[model samples]
Target: MTELVSTTPGLYPLPDWAKQDLSDLKGHQKHDLISGDEGPEIVDVYDRAREEVVSEQVDAGLDRIVEGQLRWDDMLAHPLTVHENVETGGIVRYYDNNNFYRDPQVKGELTFSGDVAAELDATSELLDDEALQAVLPGPYTLAELATNEYYDDDAAFLDAVGEFLAGEVDAFPEHETLFLLEPSLVTDAPDEDLDERVPDAIDRIVDATDADVVVQSYWGALEEKVYAHLMDANVDALGFDFVAGDRDQTLYNINEYGTKDDIALGLVNGQNTLVESPETVHERVEWTLDRIANKSFDRAYVTTNTELFYLPENRATEKLTALAEIANIPEVKA
Candidate 1:
């Protein structure tokens, strides 16, 4: 029987109070929230928010405790824009969605100063290594999100981004798993040669850390060719968005090329305001697993198809509670 675990893909929705408090702040106070030069008032707000967010995951009975990424302004671009070498350019659409992010223009050599590690370190104080899971934007996804001006060659830029992120991972606080969210692979599918190049870039990032790496792709499933090459990378597990993507194609890829030892199944819909029942989520997981009955998994994760930031805080909380129930279901474990 596959051991079922409940975890989020990681950018969690900020609670209503945090959103209200953040919105009320203006000028330097707002800027200080992301910058290191925060005042005591601003510091208190963020500390309280992160604590509350992390507590939500624990109270929900999630097996893996994600840092909730409450400090991130934008999931992909925040890490880069914070660096001295990168500049924040004009707002660009985030994939096909209505949301937008400031384009991270790479102005100089890519180097890791600091990103999610600090936030994860603070979260570590609340949870132990057994439950801690760190989240970061995948190297390929970051490369795709940024407007590269530093490196002349695209492949070189990709590798540099990988190395830069690897440096960040090398400094990360102790954790059980590292989730690299790679939504770009689905939203903006890379062509033939690029697909092959991506696995090499991903392998570099994976090679840097001792933590179990899960390369999670969302928004939709990857094409067969993309999926095949991704499987070649040295990753512990591959995550698929069963809620938003081509479920049939994802199952086919697993059956055709085969998958890693463990799999992360995105059964809960992150975008929708409506929450799913535990039984509904269980049924979906059982259906997918039954189709690939020939395969064996050491563990299977229950997750939201995308980041919960798209949904209301209450709805996201409800979604997580349901996922926990589904993981505990006798049939799901059996």
Candidate 2:
């Protein structure tokens, strides 16, 4: 029997209360906002927000739940930017969207500072009996997003970043599923040897973790060579953005390469404002499964194409509800 799971990619929008609390703390530095005397208050707000998202996921009957990543203001590049050795600099556009993230400036040797690990610990406590899926920005994406004043060579800088991220993955022993979010594979399309370096970096990052790891790329279809490279990486699953990318091309790659691992279909559009009907979602999921049936994949995950932070909280929740409904539909095993 093929296991059908419904999950989000991560970084859900903060609830209104959390957003207001953060807004009130405006002008305060990240340290003051997250660790100053008022830090406890912000942490409490995040807790409440996480609780709400967890409850919503449970209520929607999702098979896996995430912490909603409400603390990630810079999207996936956040953990790296908040590290002690890294400095936050000017804002840069995030992929092809209107959103932006503070560019992470590497001032010294890349190292883990425990901030990301601490967040994982907190989220683990909040999971209760539910299965927890941990999410992190992929090394290649993090390296692409940062300004390197420390490493003289780009390859060395990328390898150092990969080592730093692998350390982060080592900390989350409790997560059943770990997602490495790597949008830059499609957005930036490495024109150098960094393309070959990416899969090796991903392999190193997930090598020690016992959890099932999924490398999810969004924003657009990966270049042919990059896509083939990721398909051969040491991971359990690969996710493609059918909503945002060339769906036919993605399916062609999966078919041509052969689905030797689990496949996650990004059928839901997270960046849009319109809510999809349950029937429409069901049809799309069926469409994806129909294609997978001819392939040799072991499992299928129905998910949103990207983080839901682009949509309002209510709309995001609605999309989750719709996804849950689709997941509950009886599976037609291949």
Candidate 3:
């Protein structure tokens, strides 16, 4: 029997309290204040924001819950950017979207910091009995996003990043699911050499954890070769951006390179302002499952294609409600 799970990709939008200017602090100063002892008010804002996100997910009957990544000011790059040896520099476009993250300038050897783990712990404490899932940037994506000055080559850099991320995975508390967000794998499209190296790095990061790891890519469907490579990766599941990507190509890839692991169908559009109806979402999910009936999958996760932060809080909540409704449909589950 398949499990009906509804979840977000992390990084929910900031609440009104979080967006307010606190005493005119600027740039890194603001970040420092929130992360430092001088910012209890800012910390309270994030705490309340996370509580709100968790409450909504539970109310919507989602099977899994996330920390909402309320403190990820730099999106997926936050963990790396805040490292002691890394410096935040000029802004860079985050994937194909209007969002931006400061480029991470690596000044020395990369090491795992416990910031992400601490955030997860705080959020996990807030959850009643619900299973908490942690989200982190994938190794290859982080390697591509940062400017490396200490590594000898791309291969070495990827290895270091992979090891660093594995340490982060080790630091996480007992979690039911862990999502390694890898949008760069699709948006940047690594060359043949890096393509071969990426899966190795992914394996290193995933092998360190026993939790079910889902390597989720968004913005678009992966190139044929990359798609095929990920199908054979050591991860437990592969998530496709069906909402923003080519649905036909995604289904073709799944058929061509069959998977034994679960498939997370990104049925909700996280980037768009329009909220899809329950009927439309249920039909699309069934349509994909019907085409892949011959393949063996342990389960299917119905989720948004990307981070819900792109949409307003109201639309994001509505989208989650629709996903929950669709997942519970008897025909869709059957």
Give the candidate number with the greatest TM-score: 1
Give a tens-digit lDDT track for model 2, residues 102-181: 88788998766776777778777766788888888888888888899899877888888888888887877488888888
| Residue 28 accuracy (lDDT) in model 1 | 40
* Candidate 2 clashes between residue pairs 3 or more apart in a chain or in different chains: none
| lDDT-better candidate, 1 vs 2 | 1
The candidate that achieves the highest lDDT relative to the unseen native structure: 1
Q: Residue by residue across 1-334, what tens digits does model 1's lDDT show?
A: 8888888888877777877777776644222344544567766778898898888888888888888876666566678877888877877887877767778889999877866688888899987434898888888899899999999877888889888888888888888888899998998878776788888888887887888899999887788899999998899999999988688888888999999999998889999998899999889888888887578788888788888888888898898899888766785542
RMSD of model 1, in Å?
2.0
* Shift of residue 87 alpha carbon in model 2, Å: 0.8
Would you list the rank order by lDDT, best first?
A: 1, 3, 2
Residue 246 CA error for candidate 1 (Å)? 1.7
Worst 10 residues of 2 by lDDT: 28-37
For each candidate, the alpha-carbon lDDT, in order, equals 0.82, 0.80, 0.81
lDDT for residue 310 in candidate 1, whole number 0-100: 80
The residue pairs in collision within model 3 are: none
TM-score of each: 0.94, 0.93, 0.93
Each prediction's total of clashing residue pairs, residues at least 3 apart in sequence or on different chains, is 0, 0, 0
